[model samples]
Target chain A: GIQVEQSPPDLILQEGANSTLRCNFSDSVNNLQWFHQNPWGQLINLFYIPSGTKQNGRLSATTVATERYSLLYISSSQTTDSGVYFCAVPKDGGSQGNLIFGKGTKLSVKP
Target chain B: SQTIHQWPATLVQPVGSPLSLECTVEGTSNPNLYWYRQAAGRGLQLLFYSVGIGQISSEVPQNLSASRPQDRQFILSSKKLLLSDSGFYLCAWRTGTITNYGYTFGSGTRLTVV
Candidate 1:
């Protein structure tokens, strides 16, 4: 089983500010994903980055598999972005589809 | 395009009462289904996952159980609920392969037990 840990369990930012969230895994992973859990409890998939970097609008993610870590960047944050951001990796690092999730980084964007 | 649906956006159940949560996936067949729970201010915990009909794998040991009676249906059930079971339960679906795609979660069901 791989251990996933997130940094800065709690964060607060002003609207239009930028923030970075990190996820560290204890072992190598074949699957890694970033998700945003909105206020209404809807988990939206942000990115699926096993390695390398990817960008989606104001949000982007980079995964360094060799270093066993990943970073999620949110630029020009908005009130709607106030929620919990979670990064997950496969429990077995295989094709089991069992995801091991981090505690998450709770972000609060004040307007 | 595939979509996942979960029932009863919220629920309040008495201790020792039975519980059943249903999740269905549309526009896809033979997809992998999963059940996860998140306690207050806690992270998502994987409870169960199914690769196909009647194939389920439990991740944690608890009073909770899951069943996949159909290709696209996953059910979470408890014979008797416990107060500790109160949390946000989410259902998710992914393709058979674990690579190249992210898992899509449902809106989630907030359950409060008294």
Candidate 2:
């Protein structure tokens, strides 16, 4: 079983501020993903980066598979971004396997 | 485009009541389905996953069970609920062979056992 730890368990930022969340995993992984769980409890897909770097609008994710960690960057945040961000990776070596999730980073963006 | 639908956005049940939560996927066939439970402000816990109809794998030992009667349908059931079962349950789906895309999650169901 792989263990995942997310840093800065809780965070609060003024609107328009930037922030970074980190996820560290205990084992090698072939599938890694970032998700945003909104206030209503819907897990929204943010990024699927098993390795390398990817950006989507104000959000970007970088995964250093060799180092066994990943980073998520939120640029110019907004109130709507107030929620829990989770990092998940497959327990096995491939995407077809089930995921082991980290507790997550709870973020609050204030206006 | 694929989508997942989960019913009964919220539920309140007695400790001994039976429970059933249904999830159905559309626009995709032979997709992988999963059930996850999350406690308040916590990460998700994988309960069950199905690769196809009638094939289910349980990740954790619990009173809850899952069934897939159709290619795109998944059901989570419990004979008698427990107070510990109170949490947010989510249904999600992803392409079995298309590994590049991340999973798509349903809106989720909030279950509270009194």
Candidate 3:
């Protein structure tokens, strides 16, 4: 079993502010993903980055697989961004889709 | 484009009552299906995963069970619900490929056992 930890368990930011969330895993992973659980409890996939950096509009993610850490950046945060951001690393194997999820970074974007 | 549909956005069941949650995926074949429970202050815990019909792998020992009667249909059931079973339950799906495509999660069902 691998351990995944997320930093800044809670965060409160003003709208238009920028923020960074970090995720650290105990072991090497072949599958790494970022998810946003909205206020309505819907889990939306943000990124699937096992390694390297990727940007999706105002949101970006960077995963340093060698260091077993990943960083998620949100620019110009908005009230709609207030929710739980989760980092998941699934077990690496053929036909194995068990994702080990972090407790998550609870972000509160105040308007 | 794949989509996952989970039923009953919210539920309030009596303790010791039976429980059944259903999840179905569209636009994919033989996709991997999973059931996860997110408790308060606790992260999402993998409860079950199935690679194919009637093939299920339990991740944790709990009062719940899962069944994959069809390739794209997954069901989570419990004979006797407990107060501890109250939480947000999510159903997700992933392709069989080992890389590239990301997983898709459903809207989730919030279960409250009274």
Candidate 4:
């Protein structure tokens, strides 16, 4: 079993602002993903970065496996970007790719 | 492309009642399926996951159990429900490969046991 911790726990931002969210895992992971749970509870896939960096629209994520930490960057934030951001890491080298999630950071972007 | 669906988007049942939640994956075969539950403002807890048909691995020994009858079908069942079982249940699936990626989660089911 691996432990994942997300920082801040909650965040508030104004439209056109930018913020960074962090996630740290206890051990190496084979797969890592960033998810955005909207106000309506739809889990939208943001990134699947096990390593390296990826960007989509105004959102970007980077995972430093050597450091066992990942970061999600939301630039020019909009009201629609307000929700819970989750980081999920899979068990290492296991037959099952079971993801252990961290208590997400709830973001509120006010217009 | 794979899509996971969980029935009864929202449910309310009394304690000691039978509970059954079904999940189905379309557009893929032999995909690994997982069942997770999240309490309010908490992380997703791994309840059960299946690598293949009839092979389920329980992560947390709770009142819930999971079954995989078909390659792309998963079910979570309980002989009797409990008040503590109330929460948000999510079903997800991914490809079964050495290099796995992010899973696609279902719309999620909000179950409230009174």
> CA lDDT of each candidate?
0.92, 0.92, 0.91, 0.88
Q: Is candidate 2 or candidate 3 better by TM-score?
A: 2
In candidate 1 the C-alpha lDDT for residue B86 amounts to 99
Docking class of 2: high
What's the lDDT for candidate 4?
Answer: 0.88
Per-model TM-score versus the true fold: 0.97, 0.97, 0.96, 0.95
Over A2-102, each residue of candidate 1 has an lDDT whose tens digit, in order, gives 89999989999999999999999999988898999988889988998999999999999999999999999999999999999999998875576788999
Question: What CA RMSD would you report for each candidate?
Answer: 1.1, 1.2, 1.3, 1.4
Question: Which of the two, 1 or 2, has more DockQ?
Answer: 1
Local error of candidate 2 at A79, Å?
0.7
- Report the Cα interface RMSD of each model, rounded to 1 decimal: 0.8, 1.1, 1.1, 1.3
Clashes of 4: 0
**Alpha-carbon interface RMSD of model 1?**
0.8
Q: Give TM-score values for chain A, per-prediction.
A: 0.98, 0.96, 0.96, 0.95
TM-score of chain A of 1: 0.98
User: Given candidate 4, what's the lDDT at residue B7?
Assistant: 90
Worst 10 residues of 4 chain B by lDDT: B94-103
User: What is candidate 3's TM-score against the reference?
Assistant: 0.96
Candidate 3 lDDT, B82-101, residue by residue in tens: 99999999999975467775
Q: Please give, for residues A4-49, the per-residue lDDT of candidate 2 as tens digits.
A: 9999999999999999999999999887889999887888989889
Q: What are the candidates' individual DockQ scores?
A: 0.89, 0.82, 0.84, 0.76
What CAPRI grade goes to candidate 4? medium
Query: What is the Cα-based lDDT of residue B67 in candidate 1?
Result: 97
